[model samples]
Target: MLQRGGAHHRRPRAIERLVGAAKPTASIRALNFASNEMLFLQTCDIPSDITSTEALGWIGFDNTTAAEIFERYIARPDPTINPADLLQYVYGHISRLLTSNLRNLPRVQAMRVVGLNKPIRRALLDPCYDQILWTQDLHFWVKDTLKINYATLMQLQQQLGNYIHQRRSKQKQKPASVHGMSVVPPPAAELRHWQPEHTATVNMIPEDHNLPASHVTVSASPPTIREGHLMLYKGRAATESINQDGPIADDGSISMEVLSTCPGGDFNWTSPAQYWTPEKDVAEQFRRWAEQRCPYSETWLLAIQLSPEFARGLKREELWFSRDWKEYAWYCKKTKQPLSKFNHFWNDPPAGADLMEGHICTGVTTAISRMKVEEIQDRIDEDHVLQVGENETKAKQCVFLSAGAINRLGREMRGKLHIDIYAAIQSQEFSEGLEAIALK
Candidate 1:
């Protein structure tokens, strides 16, 4: 984490802002619910080039100076670097870019990345790049950029959720926030000790740690500072103030009582393909949850949070030499099989796996769409995984679950499976499961 010794320092010297024209055009398609194409596709569906960092051989900036980005990003011979080591390397690389390069200063400032696997300390940091757009500004940005009036709908949904919470007794409802799960302030219950609460409350919080593990988009809501600011949230000062003369006119753009949602992290920046899994799949979880809860509601507005790390595992070798497109994980079948030439684009089975029709394709199996609930919930699936060197039974479950939701839900995910992920630190469920996440 970025060390803060004492008082806040003066804002760093202002540098020339990065022009949009200077940066390469982002190829990712914008979200459009009205368009049949947008609604039909999955959020995790990604182009190999966009998700693959190796796809960019070099970045030529608008700067007249001839220094290209990622020059030092040489391929390492060792592919077996552990997660911790890999994280450290990435951290060091980003740090070096911020300190050493002038062209990168703009992106570095906009990102406001404090440290590897750490929350951003926005309030303390100098407003060095205020002109640039940050993640939190997406609500307004989407309206202006896409020429779509989504901001109005989003605000309405927030109001609707708030109304629901207020009308329903605390005994019956969750204190819902339209913001990403992690962005909500940590409750008094979590700040103190163990206590029995509603199962919903228990299901709300992040993982066991006191700190929020999910990425949160801070909002305009006023924050109580005496509670202790961990430099996690985006203070109201940073948010774009919305001037509502009254509740916005009902455009009926979203016909149903808009039930808006937000997961954590920057899904716009990454694909959620990492969450696909054979077990505890987000698709299965959602299918079961929806089926059991509100089978009447044909449509659900789902918000899934995609971490920055989600789609970043693509290596140079994977893009060019190797065909393994799946995220490496303990339970993923692709990780267990030997690294052989398997075409992920095609339906060809990997070497050695029995080619039963719609059965085990080994490295690349799309059979997740037809996975039975028993098969997904079964603990026996965990036993089958090939544990090579590591004996650890757990890793980040949310990441795997996100990928699983997409893989299992596929095109149906956009319409049904809303994968809103928050940091374990941010999620009540991830933190204190069945605890006090629902508490106001």
Candidate 2:
């Protein structure tokens, strides 16, 4: 017992001797100060309540000293000190500094000092072993599987929230609104840049709702899947080939497995598909239902059915609803006239091909789809290719843009710009707007 007590007493004395003997070199001073700080912390058991400045001030340690201490902790000076214990001490000091009311913390300066002209390999052997200790509020820095003590992390989160609230309260007070005065303009009539035409709202009905009383005995022969037509299957975004001619059932229901449809294009195939008997003579009702669900354009359906309502409020708002490529191509094929009809520039012959031979563009054509040449190899037809007279060997979708409209699509799609539909009307002389004055 006496030997153990003597050893404990001699430990702090050895650290004091190291500190007294340490030269003015930054690394040596840092090593000595760290030893002293660690010994003090272990003896006092004040990791929770002690402030970073208080600990540093106890031995008059500077930012360089703090940085040196951090480096030694990370380097893991094995046999001399425990890496885990030292890491815990470092975490405590930095965390206290971060959550403290100090106007400026030396934590960043200390990090910068250590990182200056230092190669990463010199500090750490394995990148995975490189640990970052962050307070819970800075969740991006904190990993999903936390390495810190759960109780300590929770306490840090509370501290951070309290600090933030106090800072915000001191910075500014909430403004009070005047009676009968509009603080902001009303919402615009047209859809804003952020708003999408359609979104799934959560007015959920039972998944298994009873069929209408009048439609009790209802059935129909399964429709044949059309060729060269886009079929919007549930759970998939990219187009894939489906069985055009499959075996039919005697009961009028389809047998093929189809994934359930949802708001997003993603399909989950884990759940088994089920057959549902169609309501007899309800083509008009189905059309109305389809219109209500996807109002921008007409949607053709096959065997699959949509639920009565989406279970959750799913807000999937895209600039355009990506239908099956076939459906999109088919729609374009039907509604659009050929680009050649509008402009003679589109009818120009290939630069290398015989001018006397002319080009396929002179021939009557209707719609064109943006299909890559390699994608449609050997199957060169109107739907597969357009006579742009350019080399289509490049690994990109080929399109004949005769007009070459300004390409602002990339920047606009990034969501930086917003349409101010009300601003235009508000600026006109016919509009009257009010400005506010502060109350005495």
Candidate 1 wrongly placed segments (more than 4 Å): 1-275, 281-410, 418-440
lDDT of each: 0.22, 0.22
lDDT of 1 at 215: 18
lDDT tens digits by residue: candidate 1, 172-250 = 4454332222112223323122121211111111111111212111111222322221111100110012232210112
Across 187-213, the per-residue lDDT of candidate 2 in tens digits comes to 222111111211111110111011111
Regions more than 4 Å wrong, model 2: 1-84, 99-110, 113-440
Predict model 2's lDDT versus the native. 0.22
Angstrom error of the Cα, residue 286, model 1: value is 18
